[model samples]
Target: MVAKGKVGILTTNYYNPDGNRIIYGGAERYGLELTKLLLELEYEVAWWQVGTGWQKEMLPGVPLYSIPETGDNFQTCPRLNQSFYEQAVQVDFAIYFVTFLAYPQVLEKSISISHGIFWDYPSFDAVIPTEELRRERLRRLWLAFNGPRKIVSVDTATIQWATTTWPGLWHKFEYIPNFVDLNLFSPSEQERKDGKIRVLFPRRLTSVRGINEAARAAEILTKKYDNLEFHFVGRAHDDNLEKEMVRWSAKHPNIYYYWKAPQDMPHVYQNVDIVLIPSKSTEGTSLSCLEAMAAGCAVITSYVGGLPNLIIDDYNGLLIRPTAANLTAAIEELAFNHDLRKRLGQKAREVAANFGLEKWKRSWAKVIGEVFK
Candidate 1:
């Protein structure tokens, strides 16, 4: 097949810059899917990221360039953006893997992606730290917004927040939620009948993803119920945090901590009866929540970001304020009430049918088609 044109994607890191190991997470998964979609559409793709000036392959024939640009004052990495802009001159189009990376400058035929509102947490104030810095940040963000032909937002929360922040930028946004592989992540043919109830927290072990709350709930609930098992199946940012989680899990008999690759997650979701997507802040239409829903597992997600968009309160899944107490109570309620769990899980699967991989690909195709045209 003939290629349409070369496309360059700029981001912080697609994989650990120092090594080939992928940082398995929602954003990375989104990037992978986007690249595949572009390839499927007969476009040549290359990826660029802040790295140690090394080159690798993101996929077969898709070059991953590492630009060794460092430090931007606003934490937006404009230097990397500039570096990619300068080096990727041959590319006909560009995709900013992160929305902020398009700031300072962007190519003429380009688009950006907003994962969700990452600064919703209170401590993010320390990043900007002053009114002048905050204003400067907003200014750069506005410039970033202006540069992208269209900003594909993973959730409406980001669009709502962005439009509220800059009242007239609505037309530049595209709402495309994350997707689930319905065929792969469907319910187990026969539900586990061993009488053991498993609750899985299948997210990266980060503070923003409510790892602390999940840990507290696991500690409290595992001690309370004999049939309950709490599984924390994700890697932390560093080896130290991973060790910490393993050590913590060792102290509790019914608690298990392990990490799985992206390909293995569907089986993990199917085995578990309940899934916890208790994100405290900084979330999108979570991939974990959708996968769990597709697997016909009862889901408990916090009422933050795009979770509310996917789950109706007490309808498809349990939506609560992402606290240790709330998570414990929700888990306990579902554990005891098997019928409620079954109903919620079944409805969640039905709802998840709407967000299938094909629908996501079609939505993205429309956006990319427009950009290429």
Candidate 2:
């Protein structure tokens, strides 16, 4: 067992120069929150950034280091060389935010916290859906084979997915739900002025996330409830899918599209009546759903991946199949009944409390304590 001492976090930094304080992405936000939790537990913490162009100004009071971007051959990269190993050796343990298992030297004393599996899943944006990409993906599997001393997943479904995809790795697995800052996403007492029922969809406009399905649902729902408004927030120029969404928005006035500005999320959630997550791909316990629940917004999502575990249908929130008809039905049900929305929102808040900052701190402390013991 590794001795208990200061812990180092190896993660990608998300400091943008646009003056946004809060990072919206799940993995980046998770790493930051984990660092805060470790600090609260009285464990000295340090950050090792793997990529370049990260702003240091936002990361005040935290000791930081940067790793130069390695080309295709990451083995020869200085970031993966002996110097990097020597620097990380100072810490008692290292927690990798994602799968960087190609460098086994670092994995010797490291724990892996993965958002998703590295090999089995195919990139949704890749143009070549051929055998070449499949073989390349197979080659990447070797990196994960080296793996980490300990593996942490965000939810039971994630753990199960990982184990099912790769057998004989269950013994090293542990479940630790994602933590969120409840203070930032609190319920507002101010009445929503807009007569239209506002629905927020905060996801990348891509096929994997089922954004097309969301748009289709909006098209169907608009026929019945003309006052309904659908707002999508994410990268606008990243893909052609977003361009298609923009075109759809132009045709329909009720549909709105906003480029994701990190600081504006809390305000966005505050104004919306419900949050929708209609992902068709594998999800690693969505942070967007958790944030919406914390903000006292009724969540309507598909019963896929870790979503079902986070949201209990008709209890904390509503879970529907990944279909336009079902999604439209769920939205219609929530929009007509104000009391049901209030009850679901209250239950969601209660569930989110379990994943508060303090709870995560305690969980990390216990894990570190056990590892040292």
Model 1 alpha-carbon drift over 4 Å, by segment: none
Residue-level lDDT for 349 in candidate 1: 99
lDDT of 2 by residue, 50-164 (tens): 4443435324566666555444232123354334557677777777666543344453556767675323235533533668765555445435434556667777775776568
Please write out the lDDT profile of model 1 over residues 267-371, one tens digit for every residue: 998899999999989999999999999999999998899999899989999999988999899999999999999999999999999999999999999998898
Candidate 2: where are CA atoms >4 Å away? 1-7, 12-23, 41-58, 61-92, 100-103, 117-147, 164-168, 190-193, 236-251, 259-264
User: What is the Cα-based TM-score of model 2?
Assistant: 0.77
Q: Residue 93 of model 1: what lDDT?
A: 94
What is the C-alpha local distance difference test score of candidate 1? Answer: 0.91
User: What's the CA error at residue 296 for candidate 2, in Å?
Assistant: 2.6
